[model samples]
Target: MKHVTKADGGRQPFDPEKVQRTLRKMGVGAEDAERIAGEIAESVPDGVRTAAVLRMIRARAKAVHPAVSHRTNLRRALGLLRSKPDFEEFVRVLLREHGYQVETGCVLAGRCGEHEVDAVAEKDGTTVFVEVKHHVSHHRVTGLDEGRIARAIIEDLQEGFRSGRCVVAIDGALIVCNTKLSEHAKRYATCRGIGHIGWDYPEERNLRTMIEETQSYPITIVAGVSRSVSTRLAAAGVVTAKQIAYGDATTIAHDADIPLKEVLLIAGRARAILEA
Candidate 1:
C-alpha cells in the first residue's frame, strides 16, 4: 500500500475512506466524496503532503460548488480569525454552543495577581477558565508550553478560590485553539486534567466536531468575507456563520457598516454551508 504524508509530518497508508469521510464532513455528498477520493488516491504521487491533497480535493470541489471548495479549506477559514480578539470571540461562541454560559474579557483573581482571561465558561455548577490560543500560521502548533502555562494560571486561580479571593470557585481550565496540539501537549493535558479542544486534538471531541454538531462556524468561513471584512464582522460581534444565516441581511449590513449586497452574498454562502 502507498502512503501519503500527513500534516503533522507523520505518514500513513493512503486511505481513500479517510479522504471521503473528510469530504462528507465538509458536506460533500457520498457519491461525490467517494469519486473525488478515488481520483486523488489513484493519481496523487506517493508521499504527497496532505496539504497538496487538500488542494487537489478543493480543485475538484469547484465542480461541486465554490462554497464546498472553500469549506474544504476549513483551516484557512479558521485562520481568518487569526487575530487574538477575533479568535477569542470565536471561542466564546463555540463554548456557548456546547451549553456553557460564557463571559468574555473577564478579570479573574489569582494567587499571584489578578489576571485577565479571554473567557470564563460556567455550566452545571462547574466553572472553567477558557483561554484562546490563536496561531496566525498553520505551521505553528500549540505545544507543551501552552498546556504548562495554562496549568500554572489555573493553579493560581485555584489557590485564589481556596483563599476566598475569587468570587467563583475555580474548577479547571480549558484551552481552545485553531492549531494542532503536539503529542506532548496532549499527554500533559491528560495528566494535568486540563481540558483542551483544538482542530484535531482529543480525538473524540475537537473544534471541528463541536462546529459540525452545531454548525457553529465562524463568519470567516463564509465564502466571500475577506480577512478585513471578517475582522469587521468580528468587531461588530458578528462571529458565526450560524448568526448570518439566521439574521436579516439588511440589519447585519447596517450594523457592520458593510454593504447590503456584500452581506447578501455572504449570507447566501453561509446558508449554503449550513444547509448542505
Candidate 2:
C-alpha cells in the first residue's frame, strides 16, 4: 500500500518537512517549497485543507519555471484573443509609449445612435477620437468606391457636433480607413473641418506617418467658422486683419457659435474679390 501525506490526501501524517522534500523531488528548491508551504498555512484555517495545500504546492512549482511563468503572466495581461480587442490593446500600448492617456472602446454619436470608436487619446488636456478600419484584401479595396464611406464620415462628424463635442473640443477626429480617401472626399472633409487619415498599406506604416504628422502640426481648429468671419468681426472693433487671423474663434464667437456654412460663404466672397 502506498502512503499518502495528509496534506495531499494521503494516509500518512501531515508533515511540512516531508512536503518540502516532495517539492524538491518535483524540481522545486527547498527554500521556495518552504516559503510556499508557509503561505498556504497562513491562508488556511487551523484545520489543514489537503486540496488547497496541494494546489499551493503546484502553483509554486509552476512559478519557479521562468518561461512558463512569463508566458502565463503575458496571457493574463493580454486578456482574451478577440481580434478588435487585440488591435485596440496594441494601439493603446503605442499611444501610452508616446505619453498619451489612451482610452479604448469610446462611444461616439453616429447618424443612427451609438458608434464604437476604437480609441480616444488625450494629452495636455486635448482629446482625439480615432476610428480604425482593417481590410484583408488589396483587390477588394482597389476596386471599391469611397463615396459612401466619405459621406458616412461626414455624417458622423455632424452627429458628433450635435452630441455637444465639437471638433474644436477634440484635437482631431481621424478616420483610419484601409483605403486612402479620394481627393474629393479629402476636400469635403477639409471644408467641414474634419481630418482624414488613410492606411492603404500595412497599418504600421500608416500609423507611423499619422503620428509624425500629428506631432508636427499638433493644433487643428474645427470651429464652425473660418478666419474671415473673425477678421470681419474684429475689423468692426478696430482689430487688424493679422490680429483677427491670429485670435481664437471662441474668443471671437462671444455669444453665439459661428455657423461653418456662413464662414464658407464669406470665404467665397473674399476669393471673388481676390480674383478681381
For each candidate, the alpha-carbon lDDT, in order, equals 0.83, 0.46
Find the number of clashing residue pairs for candidate 1: 0
TM-score of each: 0.91, 0.33
Task: Please identify model 1 stretches exceeding 4 Å from their true place.
Answer: 5-11, 65-72
Model 1: lDDT of residue 59: 77
> Candidate 2: what lDDT?
0.46
1-276 in candidate 2: lDDT tens per residue? 223344334454455775686465444667887886666555654445655566566577667733222121111122211225333444454456567787775666655655566787788886667665444332123212333454464476566676775342455555545345556665665665544545432335454354333321111111222334433443333122122233444444452245645434433433222222
Ten-residue stretch with the least lDDT total in model 2: 215-224
Weakest lDDT window of 10 consecutive positions for candidate 1: 65-74
Off by over 4 Å in 2: 1-83, 109-112, 138-172, 200-276
| True-structure lDDT of candidate 1 | 0.83
